[model samples]
Every structure is written in C-alpha cells, then in structure tokens.
Target: MRFSPVTQLSTRFDSVASDIAERLPDTTAGGPALAAGLGIGHVLVAGWNLTREINEFGAEMGPLMAFGLIGGAGLTVCVLAVRLFYSEFDSKQRWLVGWSAVGGATLFGAIVYISILVRLAEGRVIAEPIFVLSLASGMGAVAGVVVGELYATALQSAAVADRQRDQLEFMQSLFRHDVMNSLTVIQSRAEFLTQDTDGQNNRFAETILEYAQNIVGLADRVERMSDVITGRGEIETSPTELRPIVERQVTPLRKSHEEITFDVDVDEVTVVADSLLEEVVGNLVKNAVEHGYDGSDDFTVSVWTTSTGGRTQLHIADTGTGISEELRGEIFERGTSESGSGFGLFFVETMVDHYGGSVRVEANEPSGSVFVVELVTA
Candidate 1:
C-alpha cells in the first residue's frame, strides 16, 4: 500500500511531533495555569465589587478594605508562583506536579479573594479568613485532580500508538515471510518435475515451471521490496562469522554463471550484523556475474573480508564496467537500478543503516565498482 505524498508528509510530520512531545513536559501544566488565572481573576472581580459595596453603605468599611487588599495580594502571589513553578518543570512528571501546585494555589487564592469580597458586600465581614481559605483550597485540589487525569490520558494515547505500529509491522512480516516460503517450495517442486524426459509432458512442465519460476522470482522481489515499505528488513545485529553466511548465500549462484569467476578472500572473519551481510554480498556477486562485464563471457567477482580497529569489512569487488559517479547515489535508491526492479542496492542501504554500518561506492581503484561494508564486532 502506497500513501499519497500529502498523506506521507502528514504522517511524517505527526511522527516527528509525537516524538518531540513525548520528550516534552506535560501539557497538563498549561491547563492548570490557565484555569487558575481565570479563577483568580473572577474571584478578584467579585471581591472588588463587594469591597465597593461596603465602602458605599457599610458602617465599618475599614476592615473590609483591608481584607480585600489581602485577598488581592494573595491572588498576585498565586500568579507569580504559577509562573515561577511552571518554568521549573522541564519534564512531564515535573510539569504535572508544577501545574497541580500552581492550579491549586491559584484556585484557592482566587476563591478566597472572592469569598472575602462577597462577605464584605453582604455584611458578612465577621466570617473568619480561615473559613474562606479552606473552601478555596478544596476547590483548587479538585481542579488539580482533573489536570492529573489529563496527563494520564496523554500518556495512554502515546502507548496506544506504539502498540498499533508494532501490530502493523507484525502483520506485514507474517504475510511477507509466509508468501516467500510458499513460493520457494513451489519453485523447488516445479524444477524437480522438469527433470522427466517425455516431450509433451516435458514441454508442458517446462512452460509451467518457467512461469512458476517467474512467479517465484516475482514473489521474492516483492518480499524484499515490502521490507522497506514495512520497515522490517534492515540490518539486525548478532554475533556473525562472515565466511559461512557468504558461502551459503553465494553457493546457489555458482551453478548458472559458469563464465563468471568467484574469488573468496578471508577464511573466517567475524562481525556483528543482522542478515544484511548475506543480502549485500549476494546482490553484489549476482550483479557482477549478470551485468558486470556487460554480459561478456569472462569476468571475476570477489567475496572477501578484512578487519581493522575492532571493525570487520566485507568487500564485493567486480570486474564489470565500473559505475559512473553520476549514478552512485541513485543506484542505491529504490526503482533506480539498471537491473530488474532497481531495488537491490536500495535494500543494501536499508540493511547497512539497520546494522549501524556504512557503505560507499568507489571506483575499483582501476576497474569495476567496489561495494564495501564495515561492521563493528567484539
């Protein structure tokens, strides 16, 4: 399934944003600061109205004015505290804590300020300051709980996205792997049937076998191609000795290309990699035999390894026509190969990146292209 450019860009942007957000402080802090500020402002306005009323009609406006001043001062302190505390929160947990404290303090302060004004306006100035403070604190604590819940929800959402991506990759791998194995069996069976010597049956078997081989080949290509799409087929690192893997991957290619020569350099070079070493080596050798000498009768492709500074390098050098500088980068990109499907070196690049390895296409000192892979090992 291919996504449209717009969809791909959107998904890419979203992925980047989510990754950044995951590393950022919790957004819950924003909520508390906003809620607290609004709550406090409202409370202050209400208290101001009450204070004005007491000044206009009350016998003792002095105490009410004093109370209003204190309430206003408390609200100011809450605002400053929220700004200071929110700034200190550099991570999600700290943000949540900061917001909770700020929101609670602001809400409590605002409510108490409002309560004081309300009491003064309604001739309830005798009401104790502690009583008003308790009510405001309770409300602020409740609001803090809501902020905490929001943070939990955001964390849950991130977890869900991670799970979904894992499930999607798992499904793609299952289908692609099973299909390749099935095709391999079918191709093998068809080849076995082709060995019989009756003309009619042989011809029919041969044709069927040819198409079957094509289909099998197509399936193999599709499986390889799908790896990049599903992001499953990159270098997977493990303790690996190069000789056996190189030998096994290249053994099957030897029978058909008798005109092409094989040169094995190292006996037992060890390295760490996923299965990329096999794919990279196999493709280079195959490419050398098929296209290196422009379908010429005589050519040589070498499979060799070397070790330097805790890292082992695998070299696949061909005696084919050397690659032009213009095509070096493009050749490793998908749908850009001179051969079938142009995905060979694209897969190589993906594999190299997966193993934390590096690849460079340099002119073979004097002749063909040299494909080199460097891998770290213990």
Candidate 2:
C-alpha cells in the first residue's frame, strides 16, 4: 500500500505515543497518592527538626507546616491521576468528565480531612482553605494540557489507516487486469501449439508450454487477489452480446480441442456486464474441456442462453467430471484448479460480482456439470 506524507507522520506519532504509554509509569489512585503523602510527611518531619534546631519558640509553626505537607501531597496525587486518565482516554468529552470528577473528589477529600486535623490541633482552619484552593487550581491546568495532547494523537492515527487502504487497491487493479490479460494470451498460444503435434518433440514442447501457462496464470491470480484484499477492483458495467462473447472464446478453444465438440446454442441476447464477460465465459468453458470430460469418448461442452424476469441467463454445461461438493465453495477463489493455476473461476467470479450478476455450478441432469451466469438484460 502506498502511504501519503501525512500518513508517515501520523504513523510515527502513534508509534511514539504507544511507546510512551507503554514505558512510562502509571499513576494509580492509591499508589501515587500514598507515596506522595509519605514523601510530604517526611519533608514535614525534617522541617520540624530543622525549625526546632533554628529557634527555641517555634511551636506555632507545627500545624502550618503539617497543613502544607498534606495539602502538597494531595495535589501531587491529583496531578498524577490526571496524567494517567489523559493517556488512557482519547475522547475530549470522556477525559473532561473523568478528570473533573476524580480531581474534585481527591482535592475535596484532602481538604476536608486536613481541615479537621487543623481544627483539632488548636489552630484556625482559615489559612488551610487558601492553601487547598491554590493546589486545586494549579493541578487542573496541568490536567487540561495532558488531555488535549492525547486526543490530538488519536486523530492523527485514524487518518493514516484510511490512506494506506486506498493505495493498496490501486496497485491490485493494475496488476489483475493488465497483467492477467497478457498471461491469458500466452496460455492460449501454448495450448494451440500443444494440439498441433503428435511427435515427442511436439508433446514435450506442449507440456513445457502448459506448465508455463499455469505459472503465469498463478501470478495473474495473485495480482487479482491483491486487489480483493485491498478492496480496489470493482466490476464495471457494459452492454455485451452473449453470442459474440461466447463465439470469440469458443473459436480458439475449439481449435485447441478438435476431438471435443462444442454445441453452441446462444442466441443474439445482450446482457449488462463488464467487458471482461468474454474472459468469464472463456474460463468456464476452458475449465469444462480440461477437467469435465474425464477421457470420455463422446465428450461435449454446450453453451446456451435463456431469458427470465428481465434477466439474461447464460449456461455452459459439459459431459465431463463434475465438481465435488467439497471443493465447490473454493472454485471461485483465486489459485484453485483441477490441473492449472486455479485462478480461472476466480476471475470469472470477480467480474460477475462486479456487474451485480450471479454465477453458480450445479450437477447437470443425468451426468456432468452445468455453470450458469445470470446478468441483467441489456
């Protein structure tokens, strides 16, 4: 898939954010809060020792220092919680509500608990309220910035995936249509040559050509699959005469398989389908010749057309080995074949699906197999 300039930047940014989120420490409610509180408590104890050493009359400083220590610890915990929530959430609204509730709860609980402590320590709670308000305001601003950065990073990642999908489709279409056609020509010519001989030299050449064709067909099938994976190749609509399409494919196939009789029964019915309807008919018909007959002496392939309910149905049936139920589902998938690259029916299916048409295989009455493609009347 081709990626745009912006896509590269977006991917890089996502990678960096993912790394940071994975490696950086998490701020759980209890852990960071408890740790910061302990740190603040230690600082308070150290300050109390320093104050006693500095002055003999410093008893009034005790409650004020204690208030500062606990309030500072609670605010630090609040900041850590905000950072953790922002990293976890990408939506602005989710972070907005989450941080507001969490920060408010922690901040208020700390203030209330500390107020009770100050009241009981023979000290006024007036100074403690000022300290609590300052801590909450500072932490809230830091939380806002963290949440904004996380949301911005998320937006960048979504844009990149979309662009990559487009590029993959374009590449698939170019390979499927253009390259597959060329390989089909080579396969056809090789088959014709293989039929025109009876000696060892001719048979060896034909065998080599047959294998070569199979390989080429396989490569073409892979190309088509690439398009399917990327969602790029789509069937286009065109008015196609069923008779001409069948005749064009039949003429060459008939030349290759002289022993096989083709009971062509198509009328001058036209159907709405892609121009590749010719290839679709060709593959089904060729499949019958190669795999259907099973060495039966009176082997025959038949092509006919019928109309019903404003739809044109084209049928290709063969008095040959029929498809087993086990492999039926995979017949239309690329790289499936009785003796070839298995891409023939897959290409046919792709074209049929594109033009809002349908194709199916069924056991022919009495014996053999029947393949049908139904299209909208042109």
Candidate 3:
C-alpha cells in the first residue's frame, strides 16, 4: 500500500515515539512518588488544621480527638480522589498522575509560603504559615492528580497507535512470506512443465513458464521490500567503480530490451556503495525501458555518471512517454508505479537511502523522464 508523504512521516514519528515509550517506565509505575506526595500533603494539612483549631477553641477537646478529626478528614478526601480519578486511569497514565501530583504539591507549598511571608512583613494578620502551607499542599496534590490523569490519557492514545502500526506491519510480513512461498512453488512447477513439453505444448509451457517467472520475480521484489521495511538487513558499504557496475547492469538489460536504444556516458569513478548498487542501477534502467517506450523501437534510454565536489551523480534518462508531474513525486515510493509490479523504483530508493545517497526524477529534454542518483565518493 502507498501512503502520502505526510502520512508516512506521521507513521514514522509515531513508531519512534512508541519505541521511546516502551523503554520508559509506565506512568502508573510512579507509585512511590505518588504515595509520598499525597501522604505528605495530607499530614501537613491535618497537623496544621488540628493545631489551629486548638489555638482558637481552647483545649476542651482532647488532643487525640482533634488529631483524629483533622487527619481522618484529609484521609477521606484523598481516598475519594483516588476512587474517583486515579482508579479510572490505566497503568501508563497513573505514572503521569503520580509525578504531576508531586510537582503540583511542591509548587503549591512554595506559593503559600512566599505569600504568608510577604503578608507578615506587611503587618497583615492572616492564617498561620503552617496552616496556609498545609492547605496549599492538599489543594496542589488534588490538582496535580487531575492534570496527570489527563496527560496519561494522551499517552494511552499514543500507545494504542503504536500497537496498531506494529500489528499492520506484522500482517504485511506474514502476507508477503506466504505469497512468496506460493509463487515459488508455482514457478518451480511451470519450469518443470517447460522442460517436459515439446511441439505445440512447448509454446503453452513457455507462456506459463514466463508468467510464472514474472510472478516469482515479483515475489523476490516483495521479499526484498519486506527486508527493507523491517530493517532486517545491514547495508555494507565498500569502494566500488561506477563504470563497471553500470556496464554490468546495462549489458544484460540491453539484450532483454533490444527495442530501446541504450546510451552510456559514465566515466571511471569510484563511490562508496555496496553490491546492491547493481540492483539499484538495474531497476532504474528496467523501469525506463519497460515504461518509457510507446510500442516502437525509437525510444532511447541514456546512462551517465559524473563526479562533482565530493559526490558522484548517476543519471538514467529515458526518451519514452514522460511521467506526469503528479507521478514524478511518487515514482520512487513503494507501490506507486502504474506498471511493472511497482517494486523497481522502491528498491532503487531503498538501496540509495542505504548508501546515504539521494535519488530524484526530473524532466528529460525533448521528452521522457530522468532519474538522478547522487552518492558520496569514497
């Protein structure tokens, strides 16, 4: 399936975010911090309230009674908050709540402390500093928990997206593997039939064999595409001469596509690439010959390479029906071709990316399209 560049970028970003999320601890895992922050806030508020009550109302009530009343009230509030909000959140979100609660409580305490100090310096009578601090801490804790829970919801959303992407990739891999295996079997049987047939049956067998071979070729392309998608293989780079590689690819293609005129104008330039460079060049040329011609032998495909600064540029231009402006941007993307199984340019792109090179399609002079690939010289 083909995705627009914007969609592709979004998917890639999500994948990366999911990876980072997986490595980090879950949101709810911040249990210790959450517990400590809430516990401390409750203690401060309860103690301060009880002390203030006694100072204002006298010691008619026992210390234990006053303590129980204040402490129990704070505990009840915390219990309710947990039941109403914290319990509703998932594990990943719970961690956000925990940390945010701590931060909120700390921030509240600082604000209250500074306010009380400023008021006292101004000679204004107000609640005791401890009492104010305690109240602030309690409020902050509640606010923090609420905010954290909200943040956790966002995290959960991201996690879900990641899982969906992973599932999709897994399904694609399975489908590719199964289909490739089936194609291989069909190709093998077709080859066997071709070997066993003669006369009239020979023509039928050859047709079957050819189609089966094409299917098998498509399967091979899919397999390579799977490898690229899954990042299963490493690109090994070595200094390689461009002229020989281009010649080797073009020579075989020329025989197969004799109708298309071939032109080579590359010099002997060495560049940093791997064995896959041949595959890259071959696919580009194949695409040109397969799609450029208009049922005539007058189409021309040119291959040329040049070195400038520290980079080498290889150009493959075709004198066939040119790609439309809309298609130019999508030619190198997977599954974007109108013919020839759509994997050719995709493979070229993957190989070019692996070599840290860049490939682009431009309008060829007079007509047709030109594919330019730039690679760093070794």
Alpha-carbon deviation at 198 in model 1, angstroms: 16
The digit string of per-residue lDDT tens for model 3 on 1-378 reads 999999897577446544544665765435434545475558666776677677877665564464564465346446634553446566545544555666677898899888888998999988555555766666676677666556556677767867876886798778877877877787788778879988888788788878877677656655565566557657678998899988988898888877778999998889999766777887888788878887766788899988899999999999889899999888878789878768778878878888888999999989899999999998
Worst 10 residues of 3 by lDDT: 28-37
List per-candidate RMSD values in Å: 14.4, 14.7, 11.8
Most accurate candidate by TM-score: 3
What would the TM-score be for candidate 3 when compared with the true structure?
A: 0.50
lDDT of model 1 at position 202 = 76
Instruction: Evaluate all candidate structures by whole-model CA lDDT and list the values in order.
Output: 0.65, 0.66, 0.74
By lDDT, is 1 or 2 better?
2
Best by lDDT: 3
lDDT, candidate 1, 1-378, per-residue tens: 999999897577446545654766565455445445544654565466456656766748654664455455445435543653454333454344334545665677687788688878898745446435633654564455455445535656767767886886687679768876777787777677778556788787788778877676655655565665556565346887788888876677777666777787765766777544666667777776666775656567887888888877888888779888899878888899766898777777776776677877778866788888787764
Native-structure RMSD, model 3: 11.8
